[model samples]
Target: MNQDIIKSQWKQLKGEVKQKWARLTDDDLTLIEGKRDVLEGKIQERYGLARDKAEAEVRDFEQRLRKH
Candidate 1:
């Protein structure tokens, strides 16, 4: 999803994000606040994924959300 759409829908998606990345803390979600870059950073930090992999994961997650 686009940043604007992501931000607007964040509250709804937050729980699903947590479920998918259980290692992420609530504070991390707050910091992410629907910014794709921030989400990628957090995923990298928590999951130890490389930058490209983190971006791919976030992109995949966004695609899944769209499908649903």
Candidate 2:
């Protein structure tokens, strides 16, 4: 997605992100905000997943959001 579109949709996207990643604590989302890389790092640490897997998960989640 383009930066402008993502920026405009952040509020809704953020809520959806939190809902979809129920395993993520509020503190983790707060720290990451809209930064996808940071979110991936937290997912890796919390879920014990590989970096690439975490990134893929995040990407897939984002794609799902876009579809909806």
**Each model's TM-score?**
0.97, 0.78
Q: Give stretches of model 2 more than 4 Å off.
A: 2-8
CA lDDT, candidate 2, residue 3 = 53
- Per-residue lDDT over 1-68 for candidate 1, one digit per residue giving the tens place of the 0 to 100 score: 88999999999999999999999999999999999899999999999999999999999999999899
Candidate 1 stretches with Cα past 4 Å from truth are none
Candidate 2 — worst ten consecutive residues by lDDT sum? 1-10
lDDT against the true structure, per candidate, is 0.94, 0.78
Worst 10 residues of 1 by lDDT: 31-40
Predicted structure with the largest TM-score when compared to the true one: 1
- Can you give the lDDT of residue 15 in candidate 1? 99
> How big is the positional error of residue 4 in model 1, measured in Å on the Cα after superposition?
0.4
How would you encode candidate 2's per-residue C-alpha lDDT over 1-68 as one tens digit per residue? 55566556766677777777778888887787667788889989988999999989988887876787
